[model samples]
Target: MSILETTASILKLMVERQGAIRISDVIHHLGMPKSTASRVMSQLESYGYLEKDEIHGTFLPGPLIMSASHLVNRQLTLNDHVDAALRSLCERTGYTGYISMLDNQEILVLRVIHGRQSLPVVTWPGSRSPAWGTSTGRALLARFTDTQLHDFFASPQVVSQLTGSQQDVSMLVATVARTRDAGYATAVNESVADTASVSCAVGDPATHDAVAFCLSFPQQLATPEELQRIATLLKEAALTIAGKTGDTQVSSPL
Candidate 1:
């Protein structure tokens, strides 16, 4: 692999481990030379993207690298603020509210607020939903490479089960394309009857991996205009959250 790819891979591995990572570990995990891994670590440390603990002698992602992902781990854990936002959304929309992120090919619910209009939101905190059948899933797809998206669409593994709706691959691609243009994704009565959702991808342009954040409501109470409005609101909220958490350069549809 190229030097840049190797460095990026090392950084990803360090983040995944969530703690001080040793150069040896990166070398072993990536099958790269120890000297090359050490050099990468040195460069990352010089850029303030990784730091060495004197006591541990291991490297951990520094504040800068954390900011690149919008400090997603930190921001998502801000319980008080997220709760207030969820409560506000529920009050304004008269429907349940939720925040979620993409994990592989699944949507992982991070928070939820129960309102009068509640469905079988089997998705709970730390739980996941398939990425192909939901609005949040489509939004996440907006961040994939064109090649990756095309391959995913062509792959037989792309699951689609919205009853009486376009479950074909072409339809899925078109939907994602529209989502990319609109800066959000929407699903109506697809995951659940009379349910609606709008989602946008939160990501670091440098990493090219999407961390989607979304809001959902009941379809009965949501109009097309309202969905658009909600999408705008969701995008604004995501930007605010991203700014506060340090992810400032999220790719924009505009």
Candidate 2:
């Protein structure tokens, strides 16, 4: 098939599917070569037509696709004040910072700022990661109620991603509970190996457009005190970002 056909097919799949879309799905569904599928999908992502989950390499609708899919007449604003906040977080902590929103059981990255270190922990604007495993995800997941949390854990993606019989939901519950009490979340080697991150969920959890702020670095480089300090900074940035977005859901730690 021609490039047009491939693009249309991928778009159709994204529009119809409710979950994350990986390149393997495109290869499996379209019988296209891996190179071709990756190229087309990458182009779509670069053009804001498709977004890859940075952590899991899953694909989802990009801002353009989402706007059209949702009947948004205006050009979807991807970043504004949030970019500055992400940059500031990076400068303050010398860790890569992220601005993201809850997308079902994942976090959709809107922006990322690499730290002063030469090795940038880079991820695309539209990439996604499972909520159960990442600092940003856990921070947001902490907002879920008992019923919501239980139902969230039941998702195939969540259950499958969790190791061991820990699908018991109790483990996830405890993690979220800690995030709730602390007003931030931390993860080590959860998504990307050797990476440690601190995150805070900002915005109203009840709102479908909830957002989170995160900072990540190499696990070995972080001490307990440093991570805690970063978390406090992240919470402050979260509050600032949430205030800018008019989302007043973030609360102080217990």
Q: Count the backbone clashes (under 3 Å) in each candidate.
A: 0, 2
Residue 48 of model 1 has an lDDT of 81
Q: lDDT tens digits, residues 47-152, model 2? A: 9988888999998878887777455213222244456677877887678877888776777887778887533246678998777777888888887787888888
Instruction: Give me the runs in candidate 1 sitting further than 4 Å from their true place.
Output: 1-88, 120-122, 154-156, 159-166, 204-210, 245-254
| Cα-based TM-score, every candidate | 0.57, 0.61
lDDT of 1 by residue, 1-254 (tens): 87678768877686456456887898889997878777888888888888888787798777786676565554454334445555776687666666666665567777767767666554567877667778878887876778988876655444443344557767777888888778788888887667778776665434443466556666775788988888877777666545434454443533
Model 2 Cα displacement at 233 (Å)?
Answer: 0.7
In TM-score terms, candidate 2 sits at: 0.61
Error of 2 at 54 (Å): 55
Among these predictions, the greatest TM-score belongs to: 2
Q: What's the TM for model 1?
A: 0.57
How many Å off is the CA of 220 in candidate 2? 1.8
